[model samples]
Target: MGSRNSDRIPIQMRRRKCETVADMAAQGWDVLSKCQACGLVMRVNLKMIAKVSGPATSLWNRKQRCRRVGCTGFIEFQGRAPDMHWHETLAAPSDGEM
Candidate 1:
């Protein structure tokens, strides 16, 4: 009935949820939008969004249309952390370029 990792707190409880645009901005997160039809991926303009809409705007479950020429598509959004691509000094040469 004894376990070494039993006392450790769960990762879910330790992690903070970034719900709103303000929360994402405060935590250094970028909102990435991918086009459904054209398959183009681009970072969303959070500052412009916040100004036009509100800082409390939620990215999920929103029906956003893509503004690309000659393409009728929707945008799928996702959040990305700043350090996701790996920090400069920590990457190994064996890993190669991404």
Candidate 2:
């Protein structure tokens, strides 16, 4: 009798308040976004931050797809600035490390 399955969908618990990317960086909080359709999690990075800083873009309005194969689900980010200005650091490989 149901036209769509409810159990297959994911429940997204996004941040209730929106904050700027700079604020998040200042507070030591990484932009955490979860897929609303499949519960997949994606962290905001420098690239993502730069991508949304164009003339018309928003971090919260960005949509991404679930990484799992065969999962016909899409995720959107909300409750914050659509861009950021931070980058994560990684340890450099020593001597002959590729």
Give the total clashing residue pairs for model 2: 2
Worst 10 residues of 2 by lDDT: 9-18
lDDT of 1 by residue, 12-46 (tens): 22124545677767778667787779988787788
Q: After superposition, how far is residue 12 of candidate 1 from its true place, in Å?
A: 10
Q: Work out the TM-score per prediction.
A: 0.62, 0.38
- Output the lDDT of residue 7, model 2: 30
lDDT, candidate 2, 1-98, per-residue tens:
65455333221211222223544444444555566677776676634564567322334345567677877787655333223233222112233222
Off by over 4 Å in 1: 1-16, 83-98
- State the local distance difference test value for candidate 2: 0.44
- RMSD per model, one decimal: 12.6, 18.2
**Model 1 residue 86 distance off true place after TM-score fit, in angstroms:** 9.6
Worst 10 residues of 1 by lDDT: 86-95
